[model samples]
Target: MLLNNLTKKFKHWLPLAKSKIEKGASQLENSINNYDPKEIIPSKLIERLNTKLNSLPVYESYYDTLTINVHDYIHQWIINKEQNRKNCLVIKGNCVDNLYNILTSIFSEKSSLSKETIELDYQIFSLENLKQNRRDRLNYLQEKILEIQQQSDKKIILIPDLSYYFSRTIEGLEVLEKLLKLLDEDENKFWIIGCNHWLWLFLVKIYHWDAYIENARDLPLLSQENLQDILLPVLDLVEFDWNDLRRFLVELPNQNEDDHKIISQLQAKYFENLANLSQGCLGTASQLCFYSLRYVKNEETELSNLKINNPQLPDFPSITQSDRYLLFCIGLHGHLNKSDLANILGDDQIYITSQIECLVNLNLIHFLDHQNIAINPLFYSKLTKDLKDNHFLVESD
Candidate 1:
């Protein structure tokens, strides 16, 4: 079901201004802090909610939706393979869509129903550890490609996250060209490559990468319906008492519908705002959903009160242009370690470390692991616009 026009028209797209983000964040914080202790909802319900949320994989539901369309794209290639023998299909995912994980989940039992004996050779190219010697690192992958080339058998090779295989710097660009050349030359080996949207755009501009791929599909932007699909099943386990937002619920289209349908609409709007806030990123939306949940037990009204607080992107802290460039680079690569990020920026490790710490403090970029730092999904919607406004060549998606 679609969100009503009123909700659609009012979808909040926060601006690039640090002050505005900070102000909204502050307001949300105040509202939460001011909640009465006597009105505190039970910890038991909170625990139960946590259990349900933890059970849901990062973006399995959203990825399931993505797979349907992706399979269609793959199916088209399967049918048309003999006509042109064109092999690579690069998928460009919106900056924060967890596109990498989506690619991995494509072969789930539910999606793998096509009785096709496609002996798929899948490789996730993670070049994080090979920073010191990319040339050698690529040699191993190159050998694998060459081996596949020698095989007369038709191969369906999947390389999820092309961003992992190369750095965004000049050296990375040259390496990408070599890798792409190997893939392009072997028409028999149908290659399916997944890449970050911003990185794809950057490559397109630099190398006319789009021309090389010839076949590309961008994952669709998630909507409130999509967000609710992912969330409501989990939300169903806990009774949420959205007292603060009760007044805002619109009348259902028909009075004869279930009287409780109003509750569902309110929940839908709750996720609608969330989808807008997170800009269609399931990971961000999930985190926001979890944090925004608060328990309230108001003596004034006897009700099960699992509250959903309005979530805002944490303040866009004041940052220098250098911070923007560093953040953008991290986005382009999906994630980059301090050394690699510094290498890309041509800055000293000491200087880059300071910037990384400052950004982590500001909730801009966060460490995915001990070594890799990536843009925080929570701030993705605002940050992408921030980068674009600064003319950082950020992807439009």
Candidate 2:
């Protein structure tokens, strides 16, 4: 397929895009020119707001809202714009209070209007808060939706926590379904749920079809196809260079050695695939591969197998889950025991333990006689060699 065809399709909408751009530009200039810091309603703040608003995607069918700063004044500014229009809604405040306020706001609005705003405080899902009680959150969300529907004929609903909700816990998944259920069934009521990257992944994992709905405006029938078209290209844009992969692995929270090893191996396989497929694409291919790698939850062992069978040495430093595991195993004094591994890693034990056992089965690590806990002398020797060679271990005696 010709790539330029896609560009042409985008170009077809240039006139509409131009007008939006001009309006954004005008807003930005006015905000910037009138800049002042002394007042609470300073132009400096508006300038910043304009900067963010200007960067919003020009695609007309989808309504875009900056999910930043749920600060009370900032949310009021958004709601104030909707007060002039009958169709928009704003839902805002602390999570529980936001739910209560959203209910009151929806009830207080004129039901005769074709549309109304429901601005939410979106912050109620702070990691600490959401993990506290999934059931309560889900119940509150369900009630909040009904409360809003009782008040207005709002078709399009904008929820900024799509990203936050999804990533914080599985509870967000319930929130997503409730939000969709709450929306009017009509074509005009497009639900724009803005979520961050990890939450986006959670959405992708559970409701792959819904991601398409997020962008669906025209024909409901082509939601999947349209979503695929939008996602693949955007996914193609997301990638991580080898160097970036290394840095990310290093910084992962409570990162374990086994995780490092696995991630490292996955990164290698991904780049290897990139080398074969990404001839003219360069960084773009690598970036897309990075996104794909992050979602390797489905075929992790297959990826690990790929790394072992066809090792792809990254040009720069990188760690994989396998690398981490290997390091952790290396930390053992004697031959590493499978039973010891199962006891320590507990809930987190990679489901691919059997496959890893295959490595031991292949004589990579020797099992002690009559005891399943011993590491092979040869394997430990190899680990020592690798650590010394890679400077992971310092020479002693």
Candidate 3:
């Protein structure tokens, strides 16, 4: 009886032990096969941090109202011109990005009219070749205007950044005034001009640009919905994992039908926060989104395991009286080279250099090129408001 009982127990234990051995072999094989010589395993804390950053939005598109309105304006202008009306359209905006979008949209043949649209980057052209070819620049513009005037088919002449040539000096302002007068005299060609709102304001005070271009429109501010529309389409093109994003806040071993609903609500809130933080400025919103994605607390860690924090607007440093004046000067001109800034401030280059470096470190301004510096777009709208409130800018009637 004892022998028979022992035989039965062994029979039962044999299969159980074999199953355990097979499971162990399978796990060992997986470990060997998955081993990578170059892979560095991150700490649990770092892994958690990286997982958080992967949840934030990445900026992918330039969204705005300017592009759509530009197309509509050009089509309307062409139609108006056909009725023997000689009208010039001036597009003025606070942001250079908006102005650039309008110019590019018109030039890309987005309009209904099939006529040729000639585009000029007066700012870049003036900065590069104007010193050696000032006469050439003027002549070139005149020739384009004259050529478009003679064409039987409707042609549009676009001078984006028209205020680039309008220097604050007496002689420079006079030259710009004369050029506008000449353009105003032309009754044959359809002209579309893009000017910075600040520069436009200054020019109006000096030369009354309203008299020269009777039809002027400000680029409309983009709403939160508009910003969403621009970003979602781009997001669709990429291989984005909603699951990875959802895992950031709530960890579910398996996805359920309600997971989609939860993730959607979270995403909406995230984007809404972004829109509010940027104050409906598309460029600022874009920059903020990009910085959030690219930001890392520790540079030495692997990018895949890096946790990124939501980017916040810089707390602008307290400005001295002189720094306030410097900011106003830059805002007035849109952008200024160091030499031009020195001239405006009536300070020596060495003194100006120290000031500019301080501003740069404070993240109030940035270099556009080797020498030219401009106010940071993120702070531009607020800074302009402060300047106006402090009586630095002239109030409009």
Q: TM-score for every candidate vs. truth?
A: 0.72, 0.25, 0.63
The clash count for each model shown is 2, 49, 3
Task: Residues 195-296, candidate 1: write the lDDT tens digits.
Answer: 877888788776777666777777656788877877777778766575455655554335455647855666767888898887777767866776676666
Off by over 4 Å in 2: 1-136, 167-175, 184-190, 210-318, 322-397
Q: If the candidates were sorted by their lDDT against the true structure, best first, what order would they fall in?
A: 1, 3, 2
TM-score of 3: 0.63
Worst 10 residues of 3 by lDDT: 118-127
Poorest 10 consecutive residues of model 2 by lDDT? 304-313
Q: Which candidate, 1 or 2, would have the higher TM-score against the true structure?
A: 1
Please list all clashing residue pairs in model 1, or write none if there are none.
Answer: 39-297, 41-295
* Residue 58 alpha-carbon offset, candidate 1, angstroms: 6.9
Residue 318, model 3: Cα distance from true site in angstroms = 2.0
lDDT of 2 by residue, 1-397 (tens): 5789667656644533554455456546755875433222333433443344224331211211212222232334345433322222332211111122223233323241122234331222222344223345455566656665665432334453432222123454566566655442332333333332222333445466333342311101112222233223433333433333444343443345576675555445434444443331222232233223332212545431100111122222122334435443324322234443444344223432443444443334444334434333223334434555665453222
lDDT of 3: 0.56
What candidate 3 gets wrong by more than 4 Å, as runs, is 1-86, 96-98, 110-155, 225-261, 294-311, 344-347
How high is the lDDT of residue 292 in model 2? 35
Q: Which regions of candidate 1 deviate over 4 angstroms? A: 1-85, 108-113, 116-140, 233-240, 247-259, 294-306, 394-397
